[model samples]
Target: MRLVLTGTGASRGMALGRARLEHPSRYLVDERPLEESEVDAEAERLYRAIAIARDELQALREKLHGALAREVAEFIDAHSLMLADRELTSGLFELIRVGRYRASAALKMQRDRLVAVFEAMDDPYLRSRKEDIDHVIGRVQAGLARESSVEERKLAARVGEILVSDTVAPSELVPLAEHGVLGVVLSSGSQVSHSAILARSLHLPMIVAAHQALSHIQDDDLVLIDGERGEIVVHPAAQDLARFRAWQRELAQKGKRLALLRDADTRTLDGTPISLYANAESPADVAQARTLGAAGVGLYRTEFLFLQRKEIPSEDEQFLAYRDLVLGMGGLPVTIRTLDLGADKADASGLVMDDEENPALGVRGVRLTLRHPQILAVQLRAILRASGYGPVRILVPMVSTVEEMTSVRRLLKECARDLRSAGHEIAEHIELGAMIEVPAAAIALGGMIKSLDFVAIGTNDLIQYTLAVDRNNDHLANLYDPLHPAVLKLLAQTIATAQRAKRRVTLCGEMAGDRRYTALLLALGLTDFSMHPGLLLEVRETVNALHREPLRAQATALLRAPTRARIERVVENLKKAVG
Candidate 1:
């Protein structure tokens, strides 16, 4: 009998391969008491294990090249720092020498104690650091057990396998990609977790929070991973195999069709041109966007510089990064979002507060920057300096009122003045935009758009806020519907408001990247769409096949649909008409 397991579709793709379950390290070690005479020997064993773990990380670091190196370096460095931290090492030694416990037992106790502190934190990002603790301790335990060659053995034997694990770290994703691993199925994690983000960047399919994965999946079983639907089929039946083969053929054919559209102009059948932009952060992402013929970068994330670090990135460091991004676009305009460093993207750099009871509704994005003007001022200066290189725009996130947008504009001018006073050449005029993620912002965008050059609709947060559903909570997955009537009405209103004001509007959320939502967004008056570079061609193809009048008619019917079921029916009809 075929067993079907479900999870959250963390990354959007598919894979089929043999299952290779990743058994965790011995967290429950032998806790037998140690004699005083054996204490020194056990301590030596631990010391050797730590040394081995460090060397293994160093070896992996040396093997990385290009953008892959930049992506995983910080996570690996954090792990290395943990290994060298006197607090962790000293605590383990104290347990072994004073408490007379075995080497592995001492490590286990220390891991538990530290994990407790992390899990007790209010911030989800900070709380998730417990995974890092477990990973690091797992490595050390592997060293202690003299199973240092386990990874190598697994890699050698299991090429082109899907990894079924409890969790995967950001640092582990690159190696899995390089090793021909088909995809990953995690027993626990969320779609927005760092590992899932990196997997998408790497173009790897991933499923997360599959509770039955570890128990039901076994080695050598043929598995089918439908990442788009978050389903894993174990030992698929003959009909399933036939369907999967047909899907593979269709996907390949579609890929070839999209490839031919690389140089095609993005326009509807009625000859209305649409602007498609890429949301990028790294140089590799920028290169792909350039190759895909993107109009510009609609969203360039800046928070990666501030994460997994002990200090804030200096203005000069930020300037260089933004400058390179500008130059990399080959003169295309780049919209750089200011440090969005709260909520699920909290930083280790002490810049974000850790005491919020509910971070999603608390001090984050624009609120954090407004509270600390110095931080915002420095970032504005860096962005102003980068503007000297090419066309640049500054986007503010999590804005609720015209007052917040007005305040940021005031500070931007102040920073521009300071830069000129210090002998800097900057763009004479820089466009400023606000993100409409808060429901209040979307409803009140009429007053807010008057003070801004443009506005961006972040559908991910807007839907989450309007529907009152936690997108990261697997239990609420069904409730977090992007097609909810409330969400669509908010989007329609926001877009209509921006259109009436004659301000340029862009949708730069996950909804923009998904081909499924392409026509609906067009019908709702989204003239500009931005997404990952890998998704641009497919979306462009969908845009070309659409007719303006039909989409407008569908949009009219969609707005009157009072419930989610009705809204979904309207959307389905729209998709069929286009098909």
Candidate 2:
């Protein structure tokens, strides 16, 4: 029987392989009370295990290089530090000495205490750190038992198995890829998770938030992963397996055909030019974007630089990172968004206020940056400095009011003037843009566009804010509709306002990347799109097949639709016409 499981797709591709369940709990030691005579030996075993785990992490770090590797290595190094922590190491030994407990039991108690503290915090980012603690402890526990991780052992035995786990850390991805793992399915993760990013980079199929996959899936059961649709079929029936195999073959043929259109300019049948850009977080992503024919980077998220760090990055450090990205783009224009950190994306720099009851609606994005002007100033200076290398633009995220835009512009001027005073050779003209993500910003687009050089409609947050639903909350996911009449109206108004202002606007969100929405967006007069690199070729193909006049006509009717269902029907009809 074919049992289908649904999840959020984090990467794009398809894979068929036998299941390999990664049970980290298998390494956990029994919490048995130890006799006084055996306590000394158990304590020594714990210390030895900690030493081995530290050495293993160091070895892993030494074998890797590059920006992504450095980021992953930082986490691994943090794990090594945990193993070396006197409180964690010595405390476990002390517990074993006093309580006559086994070393594993002592370690488990300490881990529970630390995890409880993190769980009690109001910040989701801090709470998420418990996963890292769990991973490190799991490694040490495995070392104590003198066994490799279940993942490592399974990979050694089979080359093309699909890995199923509760959660996968970014650091483990390289090893998994090297072992030729076909795909990954996780019980928990988001599209923005480090593992997802690495998986996408490696071109590995991955599904996240597959809540029951780990429990329901048995080892060696044949599984099919549809990364595009976020579907997993376990122990698929013969007929279903044959159908999926045919789909896989078709997908491969389609990919090869799409490759032919890679070098083709992004334009409609009527020769209407559309600017296709890539959204990137790190400089390493530039290579992939360029390969996929991105005109430039439309949205360079700066938050990743702030994440997983103990302190705020210095101005020079940020400048170097920004400069590297500009240089990597080979003179292509790059719009670097200022730090969009808050809520679950909060930094560990101690500058963020994480005590808010509802972080999503609280101080975040430009508001948080404005509250901490010093941090904003440093970032502006770095961005301005990087602008000297190539074409660079500044983008402000989550702007709701004209007042916030005015404040940011003022600060940008101050930073530019100070840099000039210091004899820094900056770009003569760097365009400043506003991200129309908030409903208020979209509603007041006329005033907002007047104060900005360009605009980028961020549909992800725009939909979330307009619908008053958190897309991350599973219970509220059903309410998160991007095709709502109100959302379509806002998008149309935003594009119309930008067109009126004679300012360039780009749709740099998930909607831009989805092929299903390509026709609707084109009909809405969105000529600029910035999205994940993987979708570039497919989106370009869709654009190439489109005729501007017909799409525009279809879009007019879509905007007039009364309900979400009507809008979707119109969109579906348009897609068929164009596709």
Candidate 3:
């Protein structure tokens, strides 16, 4: 029987394949108590399991190469770090050694405790990290059982099948793709989840949050999934198959055409040139950016250096990292965002107090750095030292007031003076910018503009803050729209203000990478966009196909439109007009 199902389209593509139903493989532990004599042996067994789990992740990392390796390594590295976290490992061992619990029972107890902490948090991203706990625990449990894991079995056998599951993990996506899994259909997941992001990067068709998939989809059932539309046809008819085949051909042709534009200039149909930059973190990201012909590095996150560590990164360590980044860009301008850690980002370095009532609203980003001026000083001095290598710009994150920007400028001056006294060469002039993510900062750009050389609108946080919506919450996903009228009004105001002040502004959020918003952003007088390296070419394609003048002409209507529905309609008309 033919049936239709709907879901949130997490990744854009189309897949027609036989459905492979995946039952959730949660490891259920028996609560058998360990005898005093069995405690030591059980502890040893736990240790062996952890070591094996670590080796499995290492083996998976070794199997990947090139872009896939870089893209997937971070997820693997994160899981490995979790396995090593003393808080987790120590608690598990304590349960066995002192509490007289079985190894499996101890694992379950520790997992539950950690998951409770993640779940109590108001921040959706942090809450979603509970999924990581589940994945890591499952891996260790599989090791303890000494059996082929469900993931391993599925990876080995599933070829040309669209996997239907309750949810998928970030680490599973790449390996499954490598194994020729056609696509994925999740009964529950958020589009903003790491798994969704990876699927999009890998160009794998995926429909997340399809609550009916598992109950409705049977193994070997012919399924056609349209990732862009979030529509799944179980046992699709002949017409559905025919339509999918045609769309596949069209997409292939589009891909071939896009490949040709890699070396071409980025300009609109009306001959207006635009800047497309990359938001990068590691050396691999920088290399990918260069390969994709990105104009520069717009947002190079520094938080990764501070994470998964026992102590804060030293100035020398930071200097080397930033210096290598500047040199890697080969003199193209690089914008380095100061440490934006706090909130959902784990502070393993103990630099932050974990007892804040609301970490997101509390000391984070610029606030966290300001509170620890010595940390700020070290980062500034390192950034100043690296400026000597090539063009570098300092972008302060989460700046809510002119005072924060002013204080950073004063400290930056001091750092430069000290670097010169210490006989270090530095850039003659380094640009300073503020990430306008706070609602207060966007509204106060007029006052803050004087202190900033440039500004980057971090729409990910801006939308969250402006709408009072937790973006990572799957339930509130509908409310966390980027195209909300108020968001557009705020975005338009920021862009116009920066343009009038002759300050370069860039949108370096997820919005910048999505092709659907390219025309709208262009209309808002935004000339610079920065996104993941993998997404730049597609956005460049969107940019090249647009007539900026017509889009710009609709700016007034877009902003003045009272409702989201109206704004969307106007945007659609603008696109049609340009077409």
- Each prediction's total of clashing residue pairs, residues at least 3 apart in sequence or on different chains, is 0, 0, 0
Q: After superposition, how far is residue 21 of candidate 2 from its true place, in Å?
A: 1.7
Model 3 TM: 0.91
Worst 10 residues of 1 by lDDT: 148-157
- How do the residues 493-514 of candidate 3 rate in per-residue lDDT, one tens digit apiece? 9999999999999999889999
Please identify which of the two predictions, 1 or 3, would achieve the higher lDDT against the true structure. Answer: 3
RMSD of each: 3.4, 4.2, 2.8
lDDT of each: 0.85, 0.82, 0.87
Deviation in Å, model 1, residue 140 alpha carbon:
3.7
Q: Write the per-residue lDDT of candidate 2 for residues 93-138, one digit (tens) a residue.
A: 8889998888778778888988998778664545657787788788
The lDDT, on a scale of 0 to 1, for candidate 1 is: 0.85
Query: Which residue ranges in model 1 land beyond 4 Å of their true spot?
Result: 1-12, 25-28, 37-94, 110-133, 149-157, 191-193, 308-312, 343-349, 354-362, 467-470
**Deviation from truth (RMSD, Å), model 2:** 4.2
